[model samples]
Target chain A: MNKIEVCFSPELIHLHELQGKIVVVVDIFRATTTMVAALANGIEEISTFADLEECRRMKSQGFLIGGERNGQTVSGFDLGNSPVAFIKNEYSGQKLAMTTTNGTLAISKSANADEILIGAFPNLSATIAYIQKHRKDVLIHCAGWKGRFNLEDSLYAGALVKSLESSHEADEDGALAMKSLFEKEGHQLKGYLGQASHAKRLQNHGIEADIDFCLTLDLYDIVGKVENEKVKAVIKP
Target chain B: MNKIEVCFSPELIHLHELQGKIVVVVDIFRATTTMVAALANGIEEISTFADLEECRRMKSQGFLIGGERNGQTVSGFDLGNSPVAFIKNEYSGQKLAMTTTNGTLAISKSANADEILIGAFPNLSATIAYIQKHRKDVLIHCAGWKGRFNLEDSLYAGALVKSLESSHEADEDGALAMKSLFEKEGHQLKGYLGQASHAKRLQNHGIEADIDFCLTLDLYDIVGKVENEKVKAVIKP
Candidate 1:
């Protein structure tokens, strides 16, 4: 079996080190969560851009622009970084040029990875299934807040390790810590993360709904994989 | 009440933003723990430097040269990065120049902070006392492993918040998460961090004794303060 590793916040900074590994990009607070929901709810291919201008240029190419800034929708973009906005019927069979605060930046950093798959609670099972089938060393890349570690992202990483712990070995200390934290607190989401800084920030924003949406398990059977700077669903064999 | 923030890691990247905060540097695995233990056991002052050559130069200036690498004592040094080494009559009345994987880097980055104090479980109470007396906005900086977010450091940050919850306000999600984690598992050091990647790495290296030593509480009362590219103890009133 290929080794599966988890990269916490600091490891994510040197993301190029995982160039040879199959990568799973996770930003559960919004980016990956939105992507998982979009794909699961039947939206077609999503292209990502690091710069707003690049995404804007794609708008002229008939792509729907999607992204956000500091937790709010960017003006003139067709879709925001909200799961609700991404799950609409009108977005069906469409191309989405997406960007966000952290997740897209992570995807950009891991451009050298042999494969990049979006992982979130909603698509947890499908993501694990893909990892098992590939049997390649996996690098779980958490999109930390502003290139720093955040609570929600690390917890999601721990949650993933809990799902695939039987066959994977965590190479870094961060991976081991999150995995243990998960093993202890997997059953109690709110209680485990109630005093977390991000949870408080979310509560302050009155966006309790997003937090609930981000934590839903295995809601998406589809896998979001990156190809040519866009994330397209893999049609399961 | 000055704002109290938590820096998730000790990477140089965040140094630009932490320029004005009062930083509490935590490296429980060894560095800060060692510093606290050294001072509590009657070592006069601990001086820190990033480069070994500089430490040597400082030693020529009648200071003790001490440091470590990959959790082992540096070859030809006066001492290693363990608190156990500093607890002796040999270190009294002598200055010390030291470097380590994480703590030194954090102290260097914190050069711009209004003030910097070394913190760890070994001197948790004194650290809190220093911060309370200083009455400044504090930033708990976790000197993570090799520029990444290490769990032990975050846990230490949480431990601080857990101890001082009533007197502090967590301004960000990162702070709240750490406080929550600490509240949940701070007391049981081994139980809480036994599976951490670094701890496991140490166990693999037959250095398990250091983990227990690093986690001991109130072992020292010395406070480390930063001054012109080095850290030395501030004489308490």
Candidate 2:
């Protein structure tokens, strides 16, 4: 059987040997939520860059630039780490170049993976179906709060593990532990995330609405796949 | 109010900024379990070393040395990782020098902490009471499987956070998430840990007995303090 693993944080990326694995980049507090929202909202694709300068260069070439640092939008980007911002934007058939505290960095680091996909609550069922179709070893790469493990990302990883457990082996304790957490707290998503660090950080900035929106399950029935360094909607034919 | 935090793995040690924090080192499969069991069975003290050479030298000086690598006792050490092994060997009024794959390394890494105590399920309640009495910010540093996150340590850390919730604010979601995991799995430990990586590794080596004993709740009414570079019994004095 194929296996499921989790790199709990980007800082722990070195701890996982992800070669040839199918990877899902998750930044549930916003980045991944935005990616899924953009895809569902009909954005053409998203290019992830770890370097702000690279994202800036892409911006000059007509990419709608989205960047964030320490929970706020970059000084001049068209979008910050907000999914609702993506949903509201009039961006059809356009490229999104993204950089953020954790999400983009996690996506960028997964270059070695055989396949990479954007994941969040909104597109969760789609992501699972996609992985099951591929039937490859999977790694859920969580973009944590500034390289530290965050609750939202791990919780979503847990949800994925729970959905896939019948067909896939939990490669490590992380997979099992994460599934247990999601099972225990899956029902009270909004209430549970009220205690999350990143959620609280956003709440302090008065983006509690974003939390409620991002935690909305299966809002979009699509999976965003990374190909040629860009995340594009893998809408099944 | 003091804060409760968890370093889900030692790899995130830098993210912890452990200075001035009361740290409880946890390597639940064996090391911290052995430390508490040693104290419970009346071993005077233990000195943890990252270097096998240091432990070897201490052995020459008549310390009952314990060492492990890949779940087996190191050559020439007095004991391996099993809590039962320690309980069987009488070492009253003597010091133990220890080195292991994860636990001792975690202890050595926490040298900058304001105070360090060993934690495991066997000594859980006492460990909690000790921290409450001390009334300091706490970081539960999990000695994961070689700088990677492991299940048992994080679950025990969660148990600590859940028990201490009223008195201390959870500093991060790792703390809250950990507590939730503990609450969910605390009763079904054996069944839950049957899927854990380290537990399966041990079972492959036919040491499920160790896992069963290690998960036993508050089996010992003791707390082991790391003072003067050694872990000694803190018997309410």
Candidate 3:
């Protein structure tokens, strides 16, 4: 049996053993969704940085710099953390330097995993189909807002588990509870996601479109995996 | 407003400042349930211990001892981690020494709180009613298994949120998410809890009654709170 464990927040990522597991990092409010949209719309390389200085330094070397804090665009950067900003075909073949409040930090922390995939509602099916091909111990690592548990990330986790075509028994109470939430609220996800604190934060900044774009299901047929610290598309076997 | 934040595990305990907050400790599988039961059935005091040696020292000094590890009773202790064991008239004036895997550890971690109330399904209504009277910032500290998020605790966290009669709202997505899970699963809790991994652990040890007793809503009229490091009943005004 391919057992699944859902790590609800990155703050306690150390409690999970990621070394040999297939880790799928989900940051549904923005980062992972934007990464998928960028790749599908044709950005060649998206290098994730946990530190703004390092991400800015890469920008000086010719990468399109994109970073944000608390939903607003980072000063002196090309983009704010929004999937809407990434949904353009003009950015194809560009190497991008990316950083965000939570998602990139989650990616940096899961550096020990054997295979790391970026998961969000937009690219969920592709991500799930790719991982299902390989029978490995799976852990859904949620990049919760600033080291605390958040709804959108957990909702994404539950949706992923429910999306699986496996026998579908959750490994523990956390997994079981998440699976239940997704099943009940998965129908009106927009109504639910829109109520999230992070969603409200983005909405407060006048960016409800970002939340809407992030919640769009299966927008891209791309499965994103981490390689050399940059997230890029990989073909399904 | 009584702002509520539900801290899902001890790993995220540091993210919550307990200094002036009213922290409600939840470990529904046994510890908090047993504490409420012991106090409700009339034991004078139940001193919790995170360290086995500390709990054992009290046992050696003529206090009645009860301990559990991985859902089984600890060796040489008078009782296992069952709330039913405490529902007796004979233990009315005796003090108790308790050390468990998760619940006691949660109490030890929240030693800095202004007030620490023992929360479980047994004391659910009383705990909620007592906290609403004192408009302090509330944190529902869940004793997750081995520093990871667990379903039963999150379910209890949700139940507490839904039971609150206050006009206050949840502070973050975590609180909202927990509240959603509790309201949805609060009805078929026995079926839901029976599906949990921790419940299975107890069942494997032939302790189904513990699960039933833990799931009982508001079994006790008194709220168990920590003062002077000892758990005792407090009346609601």
Per-model lDDT: 0.74, 0.85, 0.84
lDDT of 1 by residue, B148-173 (tens): 66778888888887766767787665
What's the C-alpha lDDT at position B207 in model 3?
A: 90
Question: Per-residue lDDT of A101-168 in model 1, one digit per residue for the tens?
Answer: 57778888787788999988887898889888877777888887666666678788888777777777
Assess the local accuracy of residue B100 in candidate 3 as a C-alpha lDDT between 0 and 100: 76
lDDT by residue (tens digit), candidate 3, B112-182: 89999999888788888888888788889999888888878888888877777264478677678888887
Model 1: clashing residue pairs? A10-B148, A173-B197, A196-B177, A197-B173, A197-B177, A198-B173
Proportion of true contacts reproduced by candidate 1:
0.40
Error of 1 at B79 (Å): 2.4
Could you tell me the lDDT of residue A69 within candidate 3?
76
Q: Which residues of candidate 3, in runs, are more than 4 Å off? A: A165-168, B70-72
**lDDT by residue for model 3 (A1-237), tens:** 677779888888898899778899999888899888888888887888788988899877889888887666889998877778877676777888888758877898898999999998888888788877887777889999789888999998898787773834477666777888888889999998888888888889888788889899987888989998888889531
> Considering every candidate listed, which one attains the maximal DockQ?
2
- The number of the candidate with the highest lDDT is 2
DockQ, every prediction = 0.39, 0.79, 0.75
Ranking of predictions according to lDDT = 2, 3, 1
The lowest-lDDT stretch of 10 consecutive residues in candidate 1 chain B is B10-19
Summing lDDT over every window of 10 consecutive residues in candidate 2 chain A, give the lowest-scoring window.
A85-94
lDDT of 2 by residue, A1-237 (tens): 899999888888877878889999999988889888988888888887777877878878999998877677888888886889867648877889987658878988888999989889988998889888888999999998888888899999999999998778886888888898999999998999888877778888988878998999988888988899788899931
